[model samples]
Every structure is written in structure tokens, then in C-alpha cells.
Target: MVYSEQQIMAWASSFFWPLLRISAMFIAIPVFSGRFVDNKILVGAALMVTFFTLPLLPEHRAIDVLSHEGIMTGLQQLLIGLSVGFVLQLVFSAIIFAGQGIAYSMGLGFASMMDPTTGVSVPVVSQFYLVLATLLFLTLGGHLVLIEMLIDSFNTLPIGDIGMERSDIWSIIAWSSRIFSAGLLMALPAIVSLLMVNIAFGVVTRAAPQLNIFAVGFPITLILGTLLMWVTLTSVLGNFTNLLAESYGVIGDFLRIRR
Candidate 1:
């Protein structure tokens, strides 16, 4: 049971760094990141993974855990974990964005529901999209892939204070625009069809001033929008697959750039 201070410090550092990184990721990424997931569960999972992974990790340099360098190193690990999670967050956001757009176009913006993940009232359409995407993501083994990538990051980036570079930051910033664009693209078909329906209503109102466009147009738009949403459902799976593939690729590139 006799152990020197050096041996204890080495053991602590090995467990400490990886735990910090893993916990930070669980705080930022999906399902596990949600408020529904308890803090104790997340910490326990981090601890289990850290123990399982410690043997594969590199030797730790003895440094005072309370020292300035140690603090900086912890921050760097946090940043690395957040960056990886942020990329995936963008993918889910795109689905939510598209859902909102479609809901608005279908005149269902007022149909709001509390989002379990965000704890905010969002259009029911958006909620549906989020649920569908979550199921699809799980079906595709996205969670497993994400975990694998998280583990691979240690090998690619190593456990150190080598935080993301300026270019890496810029790349993440630039890549974020894809969220809006991809979302718009997903909702485009529905938007366009709705737009045409509105135009037709406009022409009818103009040609026959006696017609109550408000009365007739509302029902027609709602009906058409619902139908269009069903038609667009098929495309959603394909788009989600592409977006997820791109998201994972971006993650890989992000890690490679750090190297």
C-alpha cells in the first residue's frame, strides 16, 4: 500500500484529463447532453470510460494539478470536447430549423409544444422532425459512431494543451452556415409548393373580389401543406443521411486539422 507522491500524481493525471474531456462532451452532445440525463449518470459513464481507456492513453507528465499549466491543460481538453460535440449539434439544429420553416409555411406556427431537449416551446412540426431525426440517428448507429470518434480524437489530437488553431476556429465558423443552408434546402420543396398555392389564392381574390380569400384560402393552404409534408417525408430520410455523413466528415476534418 506504500506509494510515493509521484506515483499518485501520475495516476490522478491519467484519470483526470480523460474524464474532463469525456464529461465536457457529454455536456455538449445530444441525448446524453440533454437536461433529461442526470449529472450523476454522465459522471459515472465518464469515469467508467476513463478506466476502460486509461491503459491505451499515453503516459502522463507529472505536474501540479492546481498549478497554472494544469489549469490551462484542463481548459484545452474542454475546448477539444466542446468542438467535437458542437459539429454534431449543428446537424440536429438543421433539422429543427427546417421543421420550423415548414411549420410556418403550413400556417402551423401557432401549434407549439415544449421541446424536451431545449425546454422551449417550438412548433409541433419542429418537434416531429427532431424526434424523427433522433430515431433515424439512433437507427444508423450514430451514437456509437460518435463515441468511436470521441475515442479516436485522443489518438489524433493527443491529451495536451494544443487547442484549436485560428484556422480551425474559422473553419468551424464557416461550416456553421451549412446549418441554415441545409435546413432551407430541406424545407424548400414545401415552401415552394406553398408559395404557389398562395399565388393561386391571390389570383382568385383578384379575379373575384366577392370571394372571401381569408375564409377559403386558410383551409386550402393547410390541406395542401399537410399533403406536401407527407410527400416531402421521403426526401427527409435521404437528406438526413447526407447531412449526417457530412457532419461526421467535418468532425474528421476538424480533428485532422488539429493534427
Candidate 2:
């Protein structure tokens, strides 16, 4: 079929804008953004998703894609996708912070290994929590929900200059406070328990000055911390679910906001 210049531009815009959005999300979102996942695979997935969703998206690309206006529009689309993914990334960061706190309390802070996902060294406790959280994320269909929200976003925000506002940015900043509070709440039980254990060791040391607190207390605390983590797993999972829900809600709010 022969196509005119206008038709060619329209087709290119249709495919191009959605690809930018999808690819940006792939880069910023967890799982897909991990170092293990190949970039070519991500691009292919973005292409496939874009093709299927392109038909559903509104035709608003009347401007020249090679022009300055088109470049700005493309950037705006990328920003919107990245913002959505970044909000969710904060959720996982909160979990990692909680894990670090727990690990430190358990005297395992010095024992760290590289996390394959983020390619950083984190305490074994943090890695444990991350693994469980990732599994829960997938098992609960969180990824599916994310994709659905992304698709719905096109309807809410549309494809144009109308993207995240100043208020929305402030809202994201305000939401960041959850990283501290939520992280603390998740680790609070372990922290309190570990504090009592340390206090007991301190009293023992005071009563029996000849006993080496460093020698005896370290092993006891390490063992107790592991036990405490095992006992607290249920509560930790509950907190993670709550945090994930809140993250999804924040993403929804971001999309629902108007121009």
C-alpha cells in the first residue's frame, strides 16, 4: 500500500511515542530494570507492548516528530513513564531500608554480599527480604496491575504536554516520608526485641566484669537475630503488602491528576 508523507508521519508518531513511554518504564521499573535482563529483551518487550496498545491510544500526533515540539513531547512522555516507575522503586527501597535496620540490629551489618538485582552490596538480611518481596510482588499479580495502570494512564493523562504538575511532584516528595516511617514500622519489632537482648547482655557484663561481652554477646545476638527474623516474617510480609498497596495507590493518583 502506497502511503503519503502525512500518513507516514502519523504512523511513525503513533509507534514512536508509545515506544518511548514503554521503554522508559522498562528501564525504571523493578524486575525489568534489573541488570540480569537484557536491554534487547526489554526493547523487544516494549515494542510488542507498544504495538498492541497503539491501536487503543488516541491519535494526537499531528505535529512534526522531527521538529522541536515533537522532541519536547517525546521527553514529556518519557518523564511521565519514569515518574510512575520511580514511585514503585521507592516502595522496594523502603523494604531494603527496613532490612538494613534489622541486619544492623542483629549484628550482621558487616556481613554483606552483592545483590544481583541492583548490583550493590547489601546485608544478607536485606537480600532475604528483597527475595521474598520480589516473589510476593509477582505472586500477587503486582506486575499485571502495573501494566493495567500504565494502559489506563493513556486515557487519563493522554499523549501530550499535559503531564506531571508541580502539585504532583510535591505529592511524590511528601510520599517519600513513608520510606522512613514505613521502614521503621517494618523493623520495629526486631529492633525492640534486639534492644532488650543487648540490655540483658549489658547487665550481665556489669554483674560479671570478668566475662567478655564482645566474645559472649556477639554470638548470642547473631543467633537471636536470626530467630527473631524468622518469627517476624509474617508481620514483615503484612507490612510489605500494605506498602505495595500504597505504592499502587500513589501511581493511580499520579495518573488521575489532570492538566
Candidate 3:
């Protein structure tokens, strides 16, 4: 395989750009997207994977590794990667939101813990829920499927191809909002139950005029909400799993990159 300098340069160019795009996507998406993956290790790992897959990739026009278009290419890659990641982030955050609501209703709001992912204080219960959701995500192969979708993006929407259009960005914004709406629905069961408890407490206090509502209402809300959560957990998990899967599907659809 005697190759000229230009031929070698062209091969090198093709290799680096795809590698860069793949690395950017994985670096921004879930599981792989974490701060836990050190930069040195990530770069090394991505390089290895890129090289591993290089033999099988289809031909594309080689891109200049250092040029004005290359800078734009990297930025576009980063934007697409971030967009993909943010969808997953939004879905996971919805679980956190639901957890917060559940914690407040259960009187677990006072005790806070540092969330390892976000480095912020959250109700201990929310962290607990986040951990459980993380487990569920892994159990259901959410991370595996997500990473696969990312790789498929390179095929459906190749590297050095200018990334998302303006309309695509706006469409993504609309998709992101689904997380909040999904969270509200997931928490709705708990919220509605708590609201009823409050109304009951309000009515009893107003009619009797002798009850200490604050002291009594707190325990009542705490106990009843916890019981409701216990009863409704199966439904909650089912809904969450659906949301997680839907997020992957949505991201794929957005990129016009399917399995």
C-alpha cells in the first residue's frame, strides 16, 4: 500500500473529523456525558473507538483539520451533541422535579443532600429518587440505546455536514418542554391527593374553629402522601420508563437519525 503524501493527508483528514464529531456527541450525551469521565481518559477512549470503527466507515470528502470551516464544524458538532444531551437531561430532570414534589408532600423537604450530578442541595428524597432513576435507566439499557442513537447520527447525518438548522433548534425547544409537562403528569397523582388533604384540613379547621391545623395538618399530609406514593409507585415507574424511551425516540427524530 504505497500512498502519496496527499493520499495520506486525505486519509488522516477523514479520520480526525469523524472522530471529533463522535467524541463531541458522546461527551455531551448521558452516562458518557458525565463529569466522571476524565478528559484524558475520554480523549483516549474516543480515539480508540474512532480508530476501531474507522475501517468500516463510508467515504466522505476529507475535511481540513484546521481551517475556518473546521472551527464551524466543531461548533456545529458541539451544538448537535448538546442538543441531543439536553433532551436526555430534561427527561432526567423531570424525575427530579417529581421527586421534589413528592418529597415536599411527604415532609422530606427539610433534610437536604448534595446531588453528585448537579452539586446542589436537593431534598434527600430527590437524590434518593435520582439514584433509583439512574439505576432504572441502566437496567432498561437506556444508556446503551442512547449511545447507539448517537453513533447512528454520524451515519444519517454525517460529520462535516453542517448541523442543525434554525427550525430544528426551535423544534427542539418544543420537544424539551415535554419533560416539564411529563413531570407534572407524573406528579399529578401525588399533587391531587395532597390537595384534597389540604382542602379537608381547611374545611375541618374552618367549621370546628378549635383544631390546630398547622401541627395536625403536617402529619396528616406526610402520612397520607407517603401512602399514596406507595400505592401509585408502579404507575409512576411505568410512566417514567415511557418518558425515558420517548426521549430517545424524540432525539432520534429530531436528528432525522433513526436506529
Candidate 4:
């Protein structure tokens, strides 16, 4: 059977929107978006998904993709995928910031390492929390929930439409504030304990002019920090879990149509 130009355009149009969703997410997401994941792997996944989704996508068959109008449609798909990945990244970064806060309080700020996933230097304590949070995120099936939400986004906004509202962008900005808030909440237990240890050392130093408080103070804070962490570890987990859920909800609300 000979293929007409119209037939070719029909198939090509169907393919681009789905490809737009997959390709945008492939690079924007955290773990899967890492540089270590081969280009071939990402492209293969995108192609595979595009194959299945092409039939299900509503035909904006009338929308000529080569024109200025089509370019705007493409941009909208890009924004939606980027926004979804960004929300999840914020939650993980919140965990990292909390760990850094606690580490600073406990005088362990010097211990830092290059994080492979993010390609930046992070405190060892921060990285540890990040890894643990990743484990917990996977354990609680957060990744699957994120994916389901992404798929659901197609139903809400579809393709070839303006995806973001003024309020949606503000929601992202508002959620960013929680990074500092959640960080303080996670590190508060250790911060309070360390503050008391600092106060005690100041008094001891004043009382004995020759005694070096630095010699004992560091060890005391370390031990107290460890003890406080052990006592309140469950609360930390709970707080992180709540942050994760909020991240999910925020994305959902952002994708929702305004009343």
C-alpha cells in the first residue's frame, strides 16, 4: 500500500507529543535521569512508551505541528514533564538540607564528599540521609506513585494545550520554602541537644582558665548528637514521609484544573 503525505503526517503528529513527554522526563528525573544511564537506554524507554501511548492520545489531527501554534504545544508538554520531575527533586533535596543542618550543629561540616547522583559535593551526613531517603522512597513505592501521577496528567491536561496556570507556577515557589522549614524540623532534636552542650562548655571554659574546652567539647557534642538521633530517629522518618506526600499532592494540585 502506498502511503499518502496525509497518512505520514498523521503518524508523525501522533508520535511527537508522546515523545515530548518521555524525553523531557528522561532527562529531568533524578535517578533515571543520571548521566550514567546510557542514552540508548533512555531513548529505548521513550520509544517503547511512545509506541503504546500514540493510539490512546486524542487526535489534534487538525493542529499543524510545523507551524508556530504547534511549537507552543510542544513547549507545553515540556513544561508539564519538567514540573513533575522537579517536585520530586525538591523532596529529596529537603532531606539533604536537613542532614546538612544537623551536621553543622554537631561540628561535622568538614566531612563532605562528591555525590555521584547529583555531581556535587555534599556533606557525608547529608549524603547518608539522601541515600536513606532514596531507600525509603522506593520502599514506600513513591516512585510508582509519581509515575501514575505523570500518566494521569495526560488525562487532565492532554497534549497540545496550555498546561501551566499562573497559580501552578506559584505553587512550585511556595513548596520551595518548605525546604528550609523541613530542614529545621528534621535537625531540631540534635540542634537543641548540641546547644545545651555548647552552653555547658562555655561555663566550664570560664571556670577553668587553663583547661581547653575544645578538647572535650567536640567529643561531647558528637556523643550527644548520636544519642539524640537514636532517640528521635522515628520522628525524622515521619517528617520526611510527610514531605514526600506533600510533594506528590502539590504536583497533583498543580496539574488540576482551576475551579
Ranked candidates (lDDT, high to low):
2, 1, 4, 3
- Model 1 misplacement above 4 A: 257-259
Give the better candidate number (1 or 3) by TM-score.
1
The estimated TM-scores of all candidates read: 0.94, 0.96, 0.87, 0.91
lDDT of 3 by residue, 120-214 (tens): 78887667667778888899888667656766677777777866788888877888787678777778899888888888888999998887888
Report how far residue 170 has shifted in candidate 3, in Å. Answer: 1.1
Provide the RMSD of all predictions against the true structure, rounded to 1 decimal.
1.8, 1.8, 2.5, 2.2
**What are the per-residue Cα lDDT tens digits for candidate 2 across 104-140?**
9989999999987789999999999999999999999
Ranking by TM-score: 2, 1, 4, 3
Distance from true location, Cα of 88 in model 3, Å: 0.6
Give candidate 2 misplaced runs (Cα > 4 Å): 257-259
* lDDT: the better of candidates 3 and 4: 4
lDDT against true structure, model 3: 0.77
The lDDT of each candidate is 0.84, 0.87, 0.77, 0.80
- Candidate 4 wrong stretches, greater than 4 Å: 53-56, 257-259
Choose 2 or 4, whichever is better by lDDT. 2
Q: Return the TM-score for candidate 2, rounded to 2 decimals.
A: 0.96
Please report the TM-score between candidate 1 and the true structure: 0.94
